[model samples]
Target: MRTFDTDALECLAAIVEEGGFERAAVRLSVTQSAVSQRLRALEAQVGTVLLVRSRPVKPTSAGRLLIKHAMQMRLLRADLETDLQDLTPGAGALREEDRISIAINADSIATWALPALGPLVSEGLPLEIITDDQDFTHEWLREGQVLGCVTTLKQALRGCKVMPLGAMHYVAVASPAYAAENCPKGLTTHNFRQIPFIAFNRKDDLQTEFVSRACGLRRVALIQRFVPSVEGQVRAVLSGWGASVLPTLQVQSRLDSGELVNLAPDVTLPVNLYWHCWNLDSVVIDRLTAALTTAATQALKVPG
Candidate 1:
């Protein structure tokens, strides 16, 4: 039997994680040709293709399986080191590069995600976070860019575990002045059709979805403003550019201060989020998951 070598698997994992041979080489501190040679050797040993070799190299099913094992090996190595250091009275503690990288939506990151991971970071464990739109974060998981993700999808990725994170409540809000001026009769789906909407970017559909659900309509007014960042989105709403669907956590202070008013108090947008990750037995990953689950339960309202 041809057993897979941990070093070769590590090289393949790095290549998939970095998305290219040159970048992977830089990360591994080796020449690009050396990285390529390692991958070729691994493929020959397994008698199967592992990477797609495209612009951003994608992993084949076989590659993903090995990458998952490689991540597990990293965690095992960390645990071994920690166990070895237990012999010393207090030998400075074990520091390892074993990380649980997560790709999560911007809204979740801006709201409850980081707080959920606070316990892990406080314990000195490494975590890597990649923020993108909720609709797109799954691609990172599929490509092996991250070991885990907080995604909007309910289904688990192949060879991965999925757990419900909870729903985030959003409300359409606008500056007091904007509401007073454009929203004479108070904010309603009927009047919302005419008012401009503020969005995070072209990918943002919060306003559109809200308007559609509220008015039994589809698209919102085309006269829209784009603010790419979470802070910028709030600022745009505050600057009277247009109304926006703001997360409760992000606008709680402003809402309490009377700076921003709810457009429709009865209408609420609840986005359900889920935690997805590789199914691996890793102490560090298990610890992080437990902490995240605890924090999320406290921070979010559990669905009935």
Candidate 2:
């Protein structure tokens, strides 16, 4: 069994965060040579090179594993300290909360997840939010890139626990002018041929998937605008650039105000969402989960 040195692991994490040994030394309040020696010690213990020495340091595969382990351990340690402080009636002062990273889909982050996480953010628990496709968020867990994530995958990673958040419903929408020029009446194979679509990115398959099912063909329309951000994609569609699929919750006001028309009245796509987090005992993680569940229950569709 490989025994990890706490100080050495902290040094490696700092180097990865600060991007170089010299910068890491500044952050850790140590000499540059000390940082180098600590990293060398960790590498010797692990029997592999953990970091790639470059302009901006990047972690090797082995390094990512250790970094993730160190992060989890650090959070647990913080939790322990908080608990100990709570036991004392009059603690010296307030404690600083530990930061955690969460990976989620762009639509989720834009629509509901961020709002659900807002209260915790206000409480001073900083979160590193990373946007990824729902289908691929689970891979982040396996790679140890995030502590938790909102994913569409039902299965949990070995050391993770999965909780069902709810379903996000999507509707095909377009600006009135775009619909009048293109899909004036309804979604059909013939009318959609020449119409353009605003996709979130190359990874965005919602528009194409809706088109395939609605048109009875697995082919996307010819014209395309790949706006990478959620707000940008909404703007692209709103500006009459193209029609696209958007979360119904996100466009309710616009749809009601006649800014956007529902191209397909009966057409809706439902994506079930789940929360996957590290299976560890921590008060902050538990509190976050409870808040997310409460918010999701109010905004999303619960399973029967």
Candidate 3:
């Protein structure tokens, strides 16, 4: 049986999380030289190159395995802290490195994820959220960059648990004036190519997918404008920049107010989401899973 140094494991996590040796040192309250030494020592013990020396440090395959182990240990430690606090209130305080990090799609973060995590944060949970597209968020967890994630992937990764979180319904919408000017017939195939579509980012294919399905085409191309955030996309639509496929929950108020109109009332997209986390016996993970599932049940559309 082999035992590894906990300090070295945390140093590696800091380097990857903070993005560089200098930042990792700052995070760990150690000198850069010491940080490097710890990493080298750990590498010596593991007998391989653990990190790539890049602008933003990236972990090797072995390094990812180690980082996942470190995150699991941190979760167990947090659970232990909770137990100790119950026995003697205010006994242990977690350090900066002990923050619980997770990945969520940008749309969810803007809509319901933050509110679900708010109570825990208010009680000093030290939560960090990393946002990406729902289709790709699973990569964060697979790479061990985050302990948990809400993503569109249904299958559980090895050594992880998954739960369905319902689906987010999307509708094609635009400002009333824009719709009248660009899509008078309500987003027919003929007009879809003429009107610009507001995409969340280059990775976003929702607009293209929705338009293609609505038009009954194998594929269709549309003029596109990019807005990286959900709120930014909504604002761009409100400003009459372009048509967008937005969440019904996000645009319901604007639609009700007649500021935006659904371009395709009958065509809707429901993106199913799932919560994936390490299958660990930790109170923190349990609490997070509960909060997210409960909130999703109320906020997202039930899948039939």
- Estimate, for each residue in 107-194, the C-alpha lDDT of model 2 and write its tens digit: 8888888888898777556567878888888887777767788888998888989899999988888999888887778778777767
| Per-residue lDDT of model 3, residues 1-304, tens digit only | 6778999999999999999999999889999999999999999999999999988989999999899888887888888877887799888766668888899999999898899999988766878899999999999999987889999999999889999999999999999899888888898967888899999999899998899888899888889999999999999999999899989989999899999999999989899999999888889999999999999999997765
Ranking by TM-score: 3, 2, 1
Off by over 4 Å in 2: 14-37, 52-58, 88-98, 218-222
> Which is better, 1 or 3, measured by TM-score?
3
How high is each candidate's TM-score? 0.82, 0.86, 0.97
Better of 1 and 2 by TM-score: 2
**In model 3, which runs have C-alpha deviations exceeding 4 angstroms?**
none
Q: What is the lDDT of candidate 3?
A: 0.91
How good is model 3 by TM-score? 0.97
RMSD of every prediction: 3.2, 3.0, 1.2
Task: Give the per-residue Cα lDDT of candidate 3 at 188.
Answer: 93
Candidate 1's displacement at residue 115, Å, is 2.6
Candidate 1 weakest lDDT stretch, 10 residues: 88-97
TM-score of model 2 vs. true structure: 0.86
Clashing residue pairs in candidate 2 (N, C-alpha, C atoms within 3 angstroms): none
- By lDDT, the candidates rank as 3, 2, 1
